[model samples]
Target chain A: MIGGKGISIWFFIGSLLLLYGIIITIANVVEMVSPSVDKQPVLHELNFGVWWGILLLIIGSVYFFSFRPWKKK
Target chain B: MLGNLKPLLTPLMASSSSLLSLGWVDSLIIIIYFAFVLGIGYYLLRFTKTGEDFFMAGRDMTMWIAGLSFVAANLGSLELMGWAASAYQYGILATHWYWIGAIPAMLFLGIIMMPFYYISKTHSVPGYLKLRFGEGASMLSATSFGFMTVFMSGINMYSMAIVMKVVLGWDIHFSIWVSSITVLVYVVLGGLLSAIFNEVLQFMLIWLGALMIPIIGLIETGGWSGMVARIQQNFPGGDYTHLWRTMGSFQDNPMGIHWTGIVFGLGAIISFAYWTTDFLVVQRVLTAKDLRSAKMAPIIGAGFKMMVPFIVILPGLLGLAVVMPKLVPENMVSAANPHSYNEVLPLMLARYAGPGLLGLGVTALIAGFMSGMAGNVSAFATVWTYDIYRPIHVKLTKKEESDSYYVKIGRWCTVLGVLVSIGTAYMVQQFASIMDYVQALFSFFLAPLFGTVILGMLWKRATKAGGFWGLFAGMFSSVGMWAWVKLDPSALKIIALSEYAKDMAENMYRGLWCFLIVVIVTVVVSLFTEPKPEKELVGLVRGCTELPSEGHLPIWRRPIFWASIVLTVFIVLNILFW
Candidate 1:
């Protein structure tokens, strides 16, 4: 009953992805913040790390929020 | 912010990794990824108590997990590297495999084939064949599929090792064992659910790692049009940039696959055989909680499948446009060259992905390889335990076995299957490019298997004998075709109308012929043989069963509706990229 028997697999998947994305976005933001004047990291432009994080967060949010834990009916 | 960032080009370029290097940050990222994947398997193992839980995730998967896992299983390292390599060598013509070759069949599976498969409640594809065609066909399909799965796993293993060795200078044995051992530990401990869960994670990583290359490359080249201009400038008279223009004739294109062959051979036969019947992918969908989710799985996969070419194929085109100039002199000679085409994705990774990002990209490659290995191993285990072992055990013992006993057998099968795959991996270490060998095997096994399955599901009169013999004849024909080319040099040329017919071994054409022969043989044999009784055929054949209605979801939410949208995208891509 760690995540509980009733929790959908998507909830776990979404939670993991959401957490991973947050970590990546935070790391990138920190990295981007320290860029030298007139010189920027390529990571800022492509933002795949952040974008993937965002996409995973959205997907995870959908799965997590959709779960009706108390709606036995 | 990325616009002003000039891609730091590595001055040295070779297929060998001795010239390239990795730093501490990259290593740390890799270690963390490994720990996380292993942790997932260890945690999931606690929940996987029975055969169903292990193999089918206790039938609790939602549409998204099932769909993502289904597509992820197909997005193996071989697929990532091989298709990218194909694009490097064959140019845009390789897009056919992703578009027409994949979409129509995926949609067909979602809309048409899903009902029969899901309703039957079969654990594996071979189990489906057992119900439809009886023991002879099931064993044949199972044995062949079991063998093919391992061999294909080996091909993935070999390609992964080759890519790493060529690009990073990793020891071949180290690369092989690193992937195989990692996959084996998790798969054996946690079974199919572990594999599926990891597959979804790997899918995310694959997209994240591969997306940067195309985006950065397109930016540098001034978008698709700019990339097209660069390709033309790099190699003129090469219709490498045009998708359909070079497809008019075999001689007109770089791939030498004529429009006719591209459509009939690859689009219809090879694609259908793969997307429709390959248990490596279909088993993922089969793990869904219900028939509705099962049907929805491939529709969602198709939508994602359409976008995959952008991730895999664009890197190859970019390799040609940019990386080729940096490598040797002025030329596009990769296909037959020693491990040249296989270097495309890695080369792009070197250029665009630096430092911490490089670790993620490399790990993505590793993830792809392990997921593919795990998929094959899991599928092989299911077939061996359910289709091959159980019947023999029952016949010998004259008693029914416990569910837990069978689950134990499945775990052992995973171990045995992985061991055999390791052997095959080392067996074909000599072959540089595995794309052809793998395709030929698919034609031999899947074309005939697909022929039997299609007929059994669609035509009620398809007898068990017809199913078995037709599958055998079709397989026999493909092997015969392979041997014919080995003996007679002009055999493929005689069958092919286009002048530039010798580019590939033409696995596509072989698959087409195998499909036709199976259909004819099955039909002819079914007519002479006795058909199954109408009562027994319920839910197994098309007309025999009433189709289920989709729940009252909105228009956009329906699987069929989404399938149509994916198809529309497919058509639009063909027109735009043509």
Candidate 2:
């Protein structure tokens, strides 16, 4: 652990990404329900936000748990 | 290669009206990132008691941490944005900077030079010079390095503000001050430890946040083959996709330079000088916990560096194939003519990213700029304390100060450096050309300093007098050569050895000449002066120093084994593209 409070850099990164993924997925879901009037990308129908968010969540969960400070003991 | 070349700087001048508008979600992501950086700094502060702890991350970084930080230190917003623009302007030829211009030198530093640096236990590059060459050489190096590093940090600050203003329509003052204060608080709290940790975080963020552009871009353009076809169709007969096919003659390529300049000037001299000698990157590797970790760090870095072009270079190429109305140079950009080469990254971000992803992309850019500024400022603090102030303090008082005293000085130096950087940011805002001139000036030092450093490390016969005089002569001639071209623009053709050689070619050839001058002068001076005894050269010069054997490890565990793999990949990639 590089941090004095027992938080590893990996854990920190994981938590941040996890939070971001959740926020993005939730936000995009809201947008899908009530579509915004702004111009979207070429493949806006693909729902890139959901898939990319899920990928981030998967990656972040692995990092967070793998190097969690609680796991150290 | 080693220094900030024209390709890297030209994009900064290209400005347009505010391009991408950020949502509240985007602002939240950026704020969270800032909060985390400061929180980490505060958390690390309890352990940052000693000078070593503050300045060297307590000398306990793993290969991953050091390696990521090493690569991230150079992955500044300027590079990411600039090279993207260059990739649009000059084609795949800009990839030379990340590949041949970097990998060989990174491997050289890890396998050969790290032993001397680690064994000698010098805190900074100038400290190594002081040990081998004497006070005169060290003072010159330290003063120049200290000034240039902090100044570059300021330029980074100013550049980030400009990017924010142009892309997001944020006030320049707000961008500069907020970012500067954030960097100042974190770095002043935990020093290099803070910087290193944030850099590792920045590396991952950059990949995750920016990777969407290339992925979505490829999907938009069909694929690599389809993208290439479109580029060919866009600019008929223009060699924009091939790396080496168009490098045979200056007229054949968009970059307007021969392969000789790329190989000899950039690959041999500039890459070696910057990778091996520049303290900004070297300080990251210097934080490794053990000799094995130290030796393996750059190898790990090289592996990641090879993939950077996917995110950085590909986007620009995709812009060439896809960006409508076509982008123009900075000089050509105006209110009526809005599209500039520098806007390619932001334009692409706007193209592919939605609300949350947009915030993520902007956070990545901010993280890059902050980390780069922190890297320079932290390195400046360490050099200022250990190389410049501490030596003079000891010499003047004729007594060594306490460790805590130096650590205190390091903290204060961090604050001082940031204030200086803020001033420099304002100065740059007033006159943009000053940044260009200063960056070019600093570039002159690296090649010649590399010449002196390599000689001192390998040749026991290199006298102290030879090191100082050689560095002075090399720097003088480098400046002289620059002035020669400035006075008469036609001089570039002669210096770069071709009528069609562009500004980039001139930078490469000038570095090559300065390197040659240092080697010649050092050799001649050493022949006439008294050499340091071989006994005194132990742990400093290669021949006299005994390297720790990695024979106990299995073949696969050796650093050289990994380095060999990286090198093989490098060569294969070159030939693949060739």
**Interface CA RMSD of each prediction in angstroms:** 4.8, 1.8
Overall lDDT per candidate, in order of appearance: 0.78, 0.89
CA error at residue B36 for candidate 1, angstroms: 1.3
Per-residue lDDT of B1-578 in model 2, one digit per residue for the tens?
31343343223222345688766666667778888999989988887899999999999899999999999999998889999999999888889999999999999999999999999988899999999999988988889889999898888889888888888877788788888899999998989999999999999999999999999999988999989999998878787877888888888888888999999999999999999999999999999988999999999999999889998999999999998878998899866667899999999999989868988888889989988999999999999999999888998999999999999999999999999999999999889998989899889899999999999999899999999999999899998989899999888888899878888888899999999999999999999999998889999999999899999999998999999999999999988877
Q: State the lDDT of candidate 1 residue by residue for B363-418, as single tens digits.
A: 78888888889999999999999999999899999998988898899888898888
Per-candidate DockQ values are 0.17, 0.58
TM per candidate comes to: 0.88, 0.96
Top lDDT model: 2
Per-residue error (Å), model 2, residue B510? 0.9
Error of 2 at B7 (Å): 39
If you score just chain A, what TM-score does every candidate get?
A: 0.62, 0.84
How does residue B440 of candidate 1 score in lDDT? 69
Write out the backbone clash pairs for model 1.
Answer: A45-B2
Q: What TM value does chain A in model 2 reach?
A: 0.84
CA-based DockQ, model 2: 0.58
Q: Local error of candidate 2 at B544, Å?
A: 0.5
Whole-structure CA lDDT of model 2: 0.89
